[model samples]
Target: MGCALSGPGVTPEPTFSKEKRGLDLSEETECAETPEPLHLSEPQKALIRESWKILHKDIARVGVIVFVRLFETHPECKDVFFQFRDIDDLQQLKMSKELQAHSLRVMSFIEKSVARLDQVEKLEHLAFELGRSHFRYKAPPKYYEYIGAQFIQAVQPILKEHWTPEVEKAWESLFKYLTATMRRGFYTEEKTAGSGGKSPCSRKAGAGSTPNKI
Candidate 1:
């Protein structure tokens, strides 16, 4: 299974009660009229692929750091996971079996996507499907930006001698594609669901098979 970021504050407010949801773009969410497809050059792919090789090897330890930083950035996200929900201790949440499993799951998704960077369509499809799944979580485009940021912050130290601007840009490109495609899938599903306001968690599928919180 891959990662879902456990959308900490992602309950769509209008439809649900006060306790639900989140977005990445922060302010406005009017989907772009002509959302550009995020693309990567051969060199860019090479940079990302090689760089990821260094990071994935230590994903168990590094993945925890990523989630820790992620929750610290959005403490509200702690409530999204049943494991961490209502817990007062930050370290406890960080070390819980749930966080460990979930964070690693999320990393696996990252790993799968990174491995396919060379296959642009394949990569896009991965994002497309990921977006479709995330639509259920009510996660907004901006969260992609957040996830990408934490991923780098967590992996930079592990990469030590290798992290660079170019590598960061490559990861950014991948996140852009993921954000755009996910929004596309989410909105499309939302439109099709109409005012019926179906909860994404109602159906079980893919990596995030548990609840649709994140």
Candidate 2:
């Protein structure tokens, strides 16, 4: 729904060469508050959505490569995803339908989130639901930042000259909101469970997962 699941598009690769190994995406700042929803100006949302449209052209390549690069950057977290764990070969895993299917699901979430940016209530609800689902699967907060970073890297090439300061800021802001909301969901459930309440994700499997649309 988000991106076509076809061969890698012919977009020129971004210049994320070895020189960017020490890429400090953290340098991009954000709102300091935690439990708050991510705030964005209309212009920022426009820039982010427009940028995504450009990258969406090759979301299959971008999504799969994000997983590859993420594992490259943080291999310790590989086992978290059942589809990725126990793979003797990285290249083979990247091409697997399992990975592609999972990637499409993630892309779908991004597509939905971007499309609803103008509707704060809808966007926040969507984000909270996603965070709530993933929290059940034991995804830590850092995964958001790392995965988002890989995504940014994947799309940087297609963004090219249009990836301006405002665009970068917009992405950083949106990503930060995603991470914060997810963390919020994780902790909220933890608090609920601690107080002997039935957390929505207590069902064990598919508790905090994206809906079965992929």
Candidate 1 segments exceeding 4 Å error: 1-35, 195-214
Q: What TM value does model 1 have?
A: 0.73
CA lDDT of every candidate:
0.62, 0.61
The digit string of per-residue lDDT tens for model 1 on 43-136 reads 8888888987887788878878888887787775565565566666778877689888988888898898877655555655567567766656
The reply for model 2, stretches above 4 Å from the true place, is: 1-34, 198-214
Assess candidate 2 and give its lDDT.
0.61
What lDDT score goes with residue 12 in model 2?
16
CA RMSD of all predictions: 8.7, 12.4
